[model samples]
Target: MLRELPVALYCGAFAGMTSPLVAGSYSFIILAGLMSGIILAISKTSFHGFGGKLGTIAFGGVCCVSLIIYILN
Candidate 1:
């Protein structure tokens, strides 16, 4: 839990900072961060066999942001 705080913060900040320049989708940024955190937690607990935890979090964040932006536009 505590170990993933930095991951969450980094993902949130990255998404928040880039969302405006990317597409001005602030809501998607927040959603991306939350989704990434949830994914990290779940992956850490359930699927601890591949990609490690940080990789999973980062992948989840990027995928969520991309999906949201694609869907919105």
Candidate 2:
């Protein structure tokens, strides 16, 4: 996991930008970070070497959590 630490930090940074309106709780950011970590670990080859890959992953994680929060509400 040492090799993936930077990617994980980037993902966490994305999570930090989430708005209180969407998160609605502190756990939302944590959830997004965890989801992004899982995604980063599994999807290294899925996108190959495209630009914006990190952003795409971050977006996916945030969108996923937003969807979950929506459903739970």
Candidate 3:
């Protein structure tokens, strides 16, 4: 949906910046965006109002990546 575009883009940009490689970053961003969109649509409720879903997704993604790095090192 048009409403979700900005959220997706923002998430994608955040992922790309934090990720190690460009290609992999884009993939991660797209996957995160898709997952977030699906969850938001299915939930039918917003936790923090508009764009909250996307923020949650982005935060989750960052946390996951951080955990991965911590475990790997």
Candidate 4:
């Protein structure tokens, strides 16, 4: 179970680095995280062997949350 700790820590670091102004709130952060996780899962093979894949995934996650917030507000 603990074998995935490093990946979890890396994901958490990406989330933690998000600015408060952009993240807006803790809930938003959580939502962005979920979005990123979904993106990562769906894109497991699509981006294989590419550099900055995690960063791209993180950016995609933030963008998704931003779009959601934009549409709702």
Best by lDDT: 2
Q: What is the C-alpha RMSD of each candidate to the true structure, in Å?
A: 3.8, 1.5, 4.9, 1.9
The per-model lDDT (C-alpha) reads 0.64, 0.82, 0.56, 0.78
**How high is the lDDT of residue 12 in model 2?**
76
Residue-wise C-alpha lDDT for candidate 2, range 1-73, written one tens digit per residue:
7887887898778876788877777788899988877888888778776888887788888898888888997
Off by over 4 Å in 4: 1-5
The list of candidate 1 runs beyond 4 A from truth reads 1-7, 14-23, 46-56
Number of clashes recorded per candidate: 0, 0, 0, 0
Clashing pairs in 2: none
The residue pairs that clash in candidate 1, if any, are none
Model 4 alpha-carbon miss at residue 41, Å: 0.2
Candidate 3 — worst ten consecutive residues by lDDT sum? 15-24
Q: What TM-score goes with each of the models? A: 0.51, 0.82, 0.42, 0.82
**Candidate rank order under lDDT:** 2, 4, 1, 3
Clashing pairs in 3: none
The candidate with the higher lDDT, 3 or 4, is: 4
